[model samples]
Target: MPKDTDFLYVSARIKYLETKLLGKNDIERILDAPGPDEALKLLNDTEYGYDIAEMENIYEFEQVLDKSMLRTIRTLKESFENHELITFFTLKNDFHNLKVIIKSMILGKDNGYLSRLAEISPEEIKKYAEGERAANIPDSLKAAYHKAMGAYELTKDPQRIDFALDQALFDEMGKIASTSRDPFLREYLTALSDLTNIKTMLRLKKIDGDIRTLDNALVNGGSLPKEFFKEMFLESSQSLIEALESTPYHQIIDEGITQWESTGSPSVFEKLIDNFMISLARRGLYKPFGSETVIGYLAARENEIKLLRIIMVGKINGISSDMIRERLRDVYV
Candidate 1:
């Protein structure tokens, strides 16, 4: 196909697939469903689950998502024939699986602890973690792993591993977005960077952390100017409040502060930040000719899997569905 024709065909296919995405009503129904099994049933019957032979249980539901995600990637890769785009999406998944293994190994967590990870081959992840030299991994992943290892060294705290992994991933994603030729993808990247930086700042503030740590953790490449960071550092919580008053993140930050005050917990704000990022991914899908659509779709799928896992854990613990739903993430669809 001609170069121009390729995008035409792929975009057409994407449009058709987009139409099949779960609607707001679908999510509401899932939310109201009596149990995880019922939610799984609803998902199984969707166009996204054509290959799902059965989803009578949580495991099967997870299996269907795994298969669907891989199938989605295969479809995109086949349709686009854009090596950079394919590699970008594949690398994102690679980084996810890599972080899971590394964190598990470092924490002395077993394979069973990793059961919720996508159906990526455990053997492959193990081989890469064990055999591949740090320098030999993809540049983005290598940087992330190295930073993660550094974070581990900093506190010897296992929870810090995830924080470091996220910071590193943000850095790499920003770089990819800045270097991409697509303007729409670049904007998506900027939005992602802005959200990431906001989250990092909030986390640091909650922990009463210092500027050095914040600088180390902050992912660059957003439209948010350098002045914003300087202002953030100088401002008190109230001043920071004023600074963010006009920004997209204002409401999220305000809610976080309120939650921090009422419950003596920062977790709510953190969840809000995560939900915002997921929302960004969902919005990214509407833009054409950019990495946003692919990244957004992948992020959405991953969140779905995570939501199900949370529900599964809740079921195992006999927690109420309301509690489980509270912990559940906003669906990107």
Candidate 2:
């Protein structure tokens, strides 16, 4: 457990940083931008101004975003005294970069495209990937990675690889949090676990994923019933809603099912769930004394970037603000 003094300091820092997140109007402005260059002008008006100005095109926008985020994450980690905390923060990029590489190779795209992948130093990730040093992975992580890697080999489906690796990393994160003395960190992990489980269940139900397959995918420790997840395969979307009626996510799942019925597209439902999760995290950050603030800030920052990217794309495609708003994730004013 970290000392009380350290927690207080970190929380204070997080509180100050939370003020930097993009507001709702910022998103609307980006969506309303006339074109990519005009969108670039809006970005230039923000703290990310310099990064946007340097980008030669929209493709470079992603690179600049990656660099900025990684720089921010590293800056945050530098404030921590614990090597464990720093390492945990660093691994966020490790898994992300690896996934980028895996997906790029599968698509036969230029690996150089990853040069601007999530904000961790690309050079560092490349060094780690190329180095002969053994991974400093925990025993639990090593086992899960081995399983996911094996699953990757057995099924060439990138989605499978993504899910397998996702479950693996999350399980390992849980294992680490379990040993931490910080209540805020534990609570953050618990919230994350719940969100992940809910999202997985929704997607699995949509695909009518098999019972055994759902069982494998369902992470432990969420509010969802393992039995319900197993049986979710035997039911339809409506049945899933009925089964989850007692849970916090029941209404969410129901709303998604309803939208699916009306729009004949699941994108609305997907965006709703995403926005709900973001809203949940944003609300949780009011706590001024613990890791929730830290984790919440990180989550908010990532979503802010995601929202910008979404609006940037919408601008490039000349999509209407109404259409883009439908896809925007929730953001605090």
Candidate 3:
């Protein structure tokens, strides 16, 4: 095990970066910008300024976002000794990249826009998706790819691809947390998996989808057992929420269910989850040393990027600030 003092300098540097993250005022100004061009102009003065300056077309704003993420990943890799452990936080993008490649193969859409933040390079994923062995691909990726491909071939359902890959994502995250012996990540993954299962149960209930679909969609490694959800499906919505009253996620599930009831959309619950995870990560800030600081900073930075993307998309589409604000996730600052 590494000592906290080992991360002193890097943690200090991460703390400084956290101090520079966008606040409500910064986001509001961008939200109030007249159009996409003005919104792009506003970012030019922030931490994303360098990447933003490199964008040749204002509409290609995703480049700046992707580049910013790439830069963050690079910083983490170069700065940390526990690279595999830290990559747990970044590994979701790799699975996301796989989703894109598989989806492209299925739908025949242009697959040119994969995120470069993947641990398994897009090329390797593409090769694996095409049935060829690729160097350095993790077991999780290989398993997910085969499962997704096999499901699509067997059932001819594209949705199963998502479900399979998603299960792989959380399973892989849990494995990393367990392997690294990080209590924080373990708790985070537990909450994440539980909430995800809750979301899946609700969606299946809404669509009147079968229990089998729910079984497939419910991820592994949550604190709640599959049997809990198997029973939960039979309860009323209020009863389901009541059942969770003893758990830490009760408030989030309560509010999220309310949003789903009112708006008939999952976005509100997702926003709440993003906020919850950031709040979880915020605990890292007070620890003063170790990977917690890095974890906190990364969560904060990722939340900021999500906020920026929402605002930028709304700005480009002439969406009102109020509308944009509703879509915005809570800021870490």
Instruction: Give the residue spans of candidate 3 off by over 4 A.
Output: 134-136
- For candidate 2, the 10 contiguous residues with the lowest summed lDDT are 124-133
List TM-score per model, in order.
0.77, 0.82, 0.95
In candidate 3, residue 84 scores what lDDT? 56
Error of 1 at 165 (Å): 3.3
Residues 216-252, model 1: lDDT tens digits: 6666668786557755965677777677899888888
Clashes of each: 0, 1, 0
TM-score of 1: 0.77
Residue 234 in candidate 2, Cα distance off native in Å = 1.4
Cα deviation in Å at residue 182, candidate 2?
Answer: 3.8
lDDT agreement of model 3 with the native: 0.83
In candidate 3, the residue pairs with backbone N, CA or C atoms under 3 Å apart (3 or more residues apart, or in different chains) clash, namely: none
**TM-score computed on alpha carbons, candidate 3:** 0.95
